[model samples]
Target chain A: MVSGHSSYVMKHHDLPIEVHDLTVSYQKKPVLYGVDLEIEEGSFVGILGPNGAGKSTLIKTIMNMIKPNGGYVKIFGDRPRAGIKRIGYIPQKESVDWDFPVTVFDVVLMGRYGHHGWLSRIGKEDRNKASECLEQVNMLAYADRPIGNLSGGQQQRVFLARALAQESAVYLMDEPFAGVDAVTEKTIISILQEMKKAGKTLMVVHHDLASAKEYFDQLLLLNMRKVAFGSVSEVYTHELLQKTYGGKLAVLSEMATEVAKNPEP
Target chain B: MKNWVIIFGGLLISSSFLEAKQIGSGEDLNWLTQAERFIEMKDPSIRKVALGALLMGLSCGLIGSYVVTRRLSLFGDTLSHAVLPGIAVGFIWAGEKENFSLLIGAGIAGFAGVCCLSLLKKFTKIHEDSSLGIVLSAFYALGICLLTRIQKVGYTDQSGLDSFMFGQVTSLSSGDIISLLITLLLIGLFITINFRQLLVTGFDPQFSKSIGIPNDFLQFLLWMLIAFCVISSLQLVGVILVSAMLVIPAATASLFAKRLKNYLVLSSLLGAGAGISGTFFSFLGKGLPAGPLIVLFSAFLFLVILFLRPEKGIIVCWLKARSERSRIIIENTLKATFKILEQKDFQENEITSLEIMKKRGLSRREVEREIDKLASSGFCTKNLSANDEANLPPQTVMILTPKGWEYACKIVRNHRLWELYLTNEAQYEPDHVHEDAEKIEHVLGEKTVRQIERLLKNPKLDPHGKFIPSITDIHQGNLPRPS
Candidate 1:
């Protein structure tokens, strides 16, 4: 397999994520409207948008979990199914049943599914890879404990661990720190930063505006019909955020003040 | 013998030989005598029928545990009833019920029904439960229609095949016993060898699938087990009552066991016991149908266990609550005494009993009883002193022992720490953090309390500006309320 760093851009004779006029919909309602974007190799890109702005939908479309209504999305210059092993996905924790009776070790082992494929045996090597991944997230101590028993921060670590075990060059994470504590958030961000330094591409759907600049080197600001994409210093302007948030944030602050007065018991 | 058991036993005993001319007529007594002598005579026919019912019930208990726990009882019910048409077709094809073609036809029809359910799920937008309902009921109705049509043809002796609706154990030949025993053995082997895979698939399908376990193959295995359970159970409980055999024992076993292995073993025992009791009850009830009797016996045992089991049992919880309420009265007395001391009106040494009773909402008689209990428990002392005001007795100072002081301080400290943590660490509004923290305080431990305290940077005051007593001060027991 070609290393992701050598192929930062398709135009440069190397492809990371290639898409052409991708249109995705769920039950006839369009989610991605004639979207076009390319992610270069080893780029630490953050997808920034308000809730329901298709940031998650975009990730799903790229992963091929959601089929495009029209056009195409390719990962690593090929159809997603042909190269699923080269991509790592860290879905929101709520996507899975938290109460499911599986250990952190077992959850991490699932990352090897794409590599092992269907009906193939998981060997001793896979177990060692899973253990190594858990150690990276500092969750090796809790590896044997049930995933359900972990705190929100610990659970997030295990998820990151699972993604690490995938050994994919391109990592996609959706709202990794939405409900996590500061310690866990910092740990996850540091891991992503380390991955970026190692010449691996990372795309995170980030919600916090304050930490967005520190966490991401590049930002993709999106609304339904409008979009802004560039470096954090170039794209993360007040006017752009206001446009992406659809101007509701001004009213949202007023509402926050009003709600804070009655202090929602 | 119980009347229910005798009736069922006689029905089972007489039905096999009842085809004989003399046996059906004046030799009814002779058949009974023969059954009694058969045991002593070591008759293979009697042994065959007895062993057939036993193994059939055992298999129903074994595979049925999964079927019932996974909640496929009604699906099993539908497949069993649907197999009637298959049985009819088999009989027609082979020109007799005894041919191997019948079992093959039944298996094919059952597998077909399973296929229909699967196909409906895959192709249609309809929900699985709805699709299952449609297929199960439709096949059963079709089978009933076919059975009615088949009745018009000759071979009216085939009418007794309706006994499959309510199992007729006496009719099972030695061949049936061997066939059932073999099916039972296969099911047992399948469960033992694939126990871990089945457990993962049953508990968490997505995780199992994600980890590269063959989910579809395991599902096929589960469906096959259900099919075998339904088919074998129908021979004893009949198509309609087969669900009872599949569900009752497993459901009862779940009440007692948490682990999968324990659940499987207990369910087997429950199933076997229900089966034996059901068979016995049917024997005792003359002319009573065995299918209904067996289902009723299992249902009775389920009801008995539901009401009488130790944990989560109705009567036991009620009893525990009543005793706990009595204990609360004594604890409340200690609390009241401590409260009075906080005012500084009651000195450190002792105070009059009347002063303590005055603060309580309870009646005079209730306060006296509570005080006696507290003094006996060493929580406080009562002042039997002469007081001038009416008949009011002076209550002695309620001084807590070192252990009591520490326990009280822990509860108070936890409540304060939680209030601080919720406001600071969790970012809850100052006004909203106190009530929830009140309940959480009782359950938190020292490690967790310390963790929260450290996270909040050892806040001296809570969100409401109330003093949070320091742990060092709490150990000293003279932690003053903030002025």
Candidate 2:
């Protein structure tokens, strides 16, 4: 199961991730407010929202990279820091410096850093797992090449392999499909699907609505709050989509128009 | 940087800007004549200077790699400059120029500068570059004013403070060496214990943070180390120019080293080598200072590497580009020849150079040059055809050899297959696919061609209905080989 925590007694009936009453603000702008959602195990849930709706910020808050002004996150019924060893994090592609002078193998090997003691040497098992992860992404042939030499798609695959090497039960990907070629998009989706089949909980921040409907079995619609969070069929409705995509100004204007049409009856 | 180069050039021009009186006033020692004595173990002074320089180079170069890779070269400059006030304050605080006090004071000032940079970024409307410039010049000016005030007070021991400008290698006390040893050991241990954390945090802070790595703590620790590195170097390369020591060796390493581990090792070696050579040259030149000369040598090394590094050097890249351009021209000419042959339905085995020129829209001479290139490469055979003696121009007819035909068919096949794949799989419009396929044709490998061929179900025609040379067509130009 790749359970990283040896001593923490993980609860048997807990959701993979439970974010309760989360509120985050950047300066004075409220990016996310009171966002609450529970992610089930083995569910490939896509967080869908328009730009500036705080999808990535929400994910970051769950990972504890950004602390919410209010509310909390519980992974395996534990604080994020205590339960993070079992979480595989794939950040946005734009977040990394591609010119960094590391080979594909070197990057994937970093996943084993958590497993090995801080001062202990990397063992044979770490090397085998790294290669196996690379092989899963069909990128073993490029293991020796510097990550900068690869194309955008190949670079994404290398990063995916690195996350795969972590072998965690929970995968948090932030816009993994952004800027990748079509073939790479398909390859990543298929791999994520395989991860889900093996009982991994996958949370992806996706921008494309059409592909979101096709890829994710569960959908979390967010517009500065928890607008909707449920099964794909339950959440991906015309009314909910219009509500989520509609801006606060548009919603206010629509409400006013309804009041004017009813003439205060 | 423009600012740095001009200053170094200024040092080279005005070499006498530093005082003629060196540290210790051992005039008439004839250091140039006694240069062979530099490595003699009998002289403890020489050994101390060499070891101090080596230690400075080792730590500066190793830490400088992190600075350069993290895009913090300018920050290093700012931090080094920011430490000046602290040095002056340390002199005042100790009432004497003690190495330990100066180290502590400079470290505090350097970190203060880092804090100012982050604070400016967070709270102010000032841009990052402007903030760096503001912090750098303001602190430096304040330190200079303090130094001048101290000089006006006329303390005899203040002579030691003057060495902080250009550095006096002869002033390397045994105590200074001890501090340097301790600094190097601490730096080495820190990097060793936290290599992966520093690397991931530097490359992708957000990802490292998301993975539960303490990115802020690591960054804070790195800044502390950089501060210490700058302070330790003040005795070897003064405050204003020490950042160059941190930048140049690491830059030279980046020119050739493809991995971070190699970059770190090579940077240290380059730093040490430059330091020793620069000191040796100064020793040979007698009254010359070592710090500026070391920087000049480092800059020289950087230029050499930029031009001559094996893989990505400008000269190598230029040469490769030239060869690749010529290959493209040769391939394009072959494709044109194949098109001409197809126009005649392969009924005629030879086409005149004038007709080829017309098809390629080139002048007669240009077409002849291309044809000659094709013929010399054994891709085609050219015949005089009796020169059409009555005509106004001489004409030569060219026929493709089997090797030429095979390559031509390969290019054409790749072009058409790509066009088909883009149209069918990628959903590119047929018209939009042609321009992209034109550029992609010469670069597609045989394996990709086979994959596309299989993907397209071996289609006979492209979107425009042009014949795509299939596997059968490719083998037609195959001939018996000697092997």
Candidate 3:
């Protein structure tokens, strides 16, 4: 696997995330329209948007969880399925049933599913990798505890640890800080920064405007479409944020919000 | 009217076996003798039936783990009900109760039911629950019409077809058991081959897709396996009660398991356990159907787990809360005693009950009762004053023993330190910290107390300008305690 460095980008090579005129819809209603983006390697990017602004839709489309109707997503200049093994995804915590009969360790070990074959038993290397990820999130103490027995913060950390154990070059996190305690938020941000330092690209869907400036080096301002995408000081301006959050696309936003909350396959 | 007649006829046949045994004995069947007969495994027919029950339980319970966990309990019910038509068609096509014909027909009908569900979801605006209800009742009605029509035709080979509705476990031949054995082996091998991928897909589909897992294929395979399980167990548990076998044993094991592997293993055991016990009791009563009897046994098992299991059980949670409530009460009483001593500037160790009543805002009787509780716990002693008999009754004064004084000081320190910490670390207003600290003081562990002290730099004064007692002063029970 090629290291995700922008030296390749400077040589006009494949970007970590390359999207051109992507359009996505659900139930014959559009959620994302004509969005374009290119993310450099090792950049800590925060996608700041209001509810139903298609932030999650964009990430899902990129991962091929949802296909774009208009355009396409390319990771390192290939189709998503071909490049999906190089990406780690941490979905919203509310998306899963915590009452499932699986321990924190078992959840983390699931991150290694892509690394090994389906028939092979979970080896010792996978166990060690999972615990290492748990240790990074300060959840090693709760590794043996059932997922339902954990608090909300611990559940969030378990998913984050799973993402870490995936050991992918690109990480996509959806609302990692939502519903977690202040201490857990701090730990997650620090880990994201560490990942950025290690030449890994990180894209986080963040809702808080105040912390968005401090947490991310780049910001992807989105509403129903791409309002702005650039450095935090440039795209995070008040004018652009107002344009993204303003109710110009009321019908589109409302329909997309309902669709996102009750997604059907 | 016809449906009701068919159902009643099936019931009458089920109960008639017991009537024959009762008439032979001229009384109730001997339960002890039946139990000995079952345990001896001396009869080949009895052994075959028992083995058949055990096999059904193991496979249904194993597959049921996935059914409940995937939120497909209702789907399992619909699928089981929908296979009735296939069973009837297979019986007519083969001109007998042929296992191979029945298996193929059931598998086709089950798969067709799933396909219909997908089509309904894709083409129509009808929701999932309504679609399932339509398919289940529709297929079931078709099966009922065929069954009643066949009985009207009156063929000799149709003599044992009613057993399909409510199983006649005694009628299971060795051929039936062999087919069931093969089906279960296939289910086991499939699960082992695709265990990790199936688990990840079940828990989180989007995440699985991101990792390039073929989620749709795995789900289709799982649906097929569920159909196989229901089909194989039909002769032992029957169609109407088959879903109970799938859901109950898994739910029973979920109470004890914290992981998927444990859920699978423990559910299989509980399934086997219910099977043996139900078969035993059915043998004992001499008239009980295995379907209802097995379901009842598993339901009883679930109730036991709900009430008696450790940690997550309702009874255990109630008991834990009760103890926590009493501990909070004890801590509050100790804090009241400390505040009484503080009001006097720590000039004495003994406090009058009137002072406690005023400090704790309790009635005089309440204060005396609290003191009695403290005395019994070895925290304090109660003495009657000489002037107590002067005013129609003796006056009570409580003297704290060293242990009592130590606890009192510790409670005071915890309260003050929490108040200080809230104002400093949490940025709470000074006046707002007391109410929150009221609850936090009782639960703060020693490690947290040390952290609070360190963060506050060992403050001697709380937000309200009260002197925070030290642990050493608490142990010494010293009046006018030093900083």
Candidate 4:
């Protein structure tokens, strides 16, 4: 399986994600500005930032959900739309409507949708894949349950199962650990570590500083812009964290506001 | 299962096309004859009207599932009203009451209303509900003005224009039927091809976009489908009641369906059923309007499902609550019996009804009823003890059977164990644990009880110094006897 995936990876650029000078603004308020990143193919990277420091915005911009005002993001040297097929995304739990009438199996099956034409039937292979993913997450017993009938940790596990079903080479997750139980958090981090060992690249938006340092091999400290990007041992220092979190960059925010008011062109 | 529904729906639609003899328009005909006439498919115009209603129902139900699921029901209503101006403009542009032009005009008007709503939401601080209200009323007023102007102008083909407010089924033409059929087909194909994409986007648009699903395009397409459905339905249900067709049947289906696939199928079926039955009732009553009757029928279905559905219906929930209340009462009575036995230090095998009445704080009559209930269920046995005093009524003595004794021990054990667990593990005061344990003891399962016992290290006594019945003691139905 590893050999097969490595061959698949060799078909694309070694760098799974590349962002150059990306800037994003929502309703004329800049969220991410002049951000640049290049993630290796098999590394686990954690994005650490304070509240409102554009962690989710950077992930969204990379997914092409929000168009950047300047610069561009490429996945495997292709545009976001084309490269996204190779990406699996786990969104924030609060962003979904739990009352939606879908079973756990149905949600997991949706992961395979990108692999087939929109009109194609979900074949036996797809069903088996979905069941396998559910089994991996230990949610097989809940395959027929409505999504609303789950606890917070169980819901996060279901999302993780869906991402596993996608079988993508790259993953972008937003706060998968938020509100989850301790066992679920451990289960998720272990699975992520296994995925990294299997040659899949992962970038996760994490809020817990302690776990962030222990979980990922590399860290990206963000505060409206990239403050530091290096290995955990190099960038996890008090000085860099203070720089990422401290409000000493009042001039940068003023510049953000000014940029929002006027276009570079 | 899905194919069966589709086939059944197709047969129902096709059955309306069968040829039959025309019935006479008799002013004095009774209700049964009118019903016979409706079943005959006799009049060509009646067949056309029936087909139109079915098609309208099918399309509205199909699109309304998405509308209701996405929380866009009000948007559907706003779009329905927003199409009036387009109808008026189409009438003026066509220089007559042309079905095709009217439908096109209404579609455009619905699209424009959606655009205006989105713009108001995107550019300003106005909330979605307020923006929907603005677009709904503003377009409706404009259309009303245009419609009144057309009437004042007095065109030759303007006779049936006012019927758009409240539908006139007699005005349905073959053109209208064909357009409704086209709309139904389009909606069916769109849903079939994009079911997963639509589901994901509706459930989570942000995630859908990340997976390369064109969230914006799908949203726009859904809006277009809604507009098409509303526009085609206007001739049969009119603008005022069209939104009801979109929402009512879907709401009824949502009450019982656990999956989106079932919800859509059931909704469309209910919509079709409502359409046929409403048209039938309107047929029975010579001058009754079909549109309002259809909406009323669907509303009736919603009420019926809301109260009678098998799992979560109001009546089911009420019955469940009633049973739960009785069970709690029975368990409480058993606990009271055990308390009395414990007070006697296991020396006595029987207790008097007067003692129970005292322990439970109940009247003599209520105690008699409780003992009777317990005896009937084989939980305990009651008998009149030999009365030495002839003047006083004989006192009733109750003895717990083995099952009853074991049950009472288990309840006591659960209560005592929970109280101990709460006071020790949950950090509750010893005084505060009894009230909570009172409620939880009846509902705690065996597995949870064992887990709590293990967590608390299998303590033998509660915080109040009461012996918690051991599992072995409960199994043996054992109580200490006097040496």
TM-scores, all candidates, are: 0.64, 0.77, 0.79, 0.86
lDDT of 1 by residue, B375-425 (tens): 676655445655576575643434455554445456656777888788777
- All candidates' chain B TM-scores are 0.68, 0.74, 0.85, 0.86
Q: Between candidates 3 and 4, which one is better according to lDDT?
A: 4
TM (B chain), model 1: 0.68
Kindly list the per-residue Cα lDDT of model 3 for residues B1-483, writing each as its tens digit. 967787566445444433211101223758888788778988787677778778888888888999989988888988987898898898889988777897788888888889999999999999898999999877876776676667777766885666666666766777779877876898789788888877887788778888888889988888988998888887777777789999999998888888888899988888888887777777776456666788789999999898989988989999999989877777788889888877777777778888787888899898888888889989888898765556656668888877787787888899999998988889999999999889888888888888888888888999999989866565565646312
Better of 2 and 4 by TM-score: 4
* Order of quality (TM-score): 4, 3, 2, 1
Q: Which one wins on DockQ? A: 4
Q: In model 1, what is the error at residue B59, expressed in angstroms?
A: 5.5
Ten residues in sequence with the least summed lDDT for candidate 4 chain B: B14-23
Candidates 2 and 3 compared by DockQ, better number: 3
| Model 1 misplacement above 4 A | A1-158, A165-190, A194-265, B1-77, B122-124, B149-156, B172-214, B244-327, B339-357, B368-372, B375-483
Whole-model lDDT, model 2: 0.81
Clashing pairs in 3: B388-B394, B388-B395
Q: TM-score of model 3 relative to the true fold?
A: 0.79
Instruction: Tell me how many residue pairs clash in candidate 3.
Output: 2
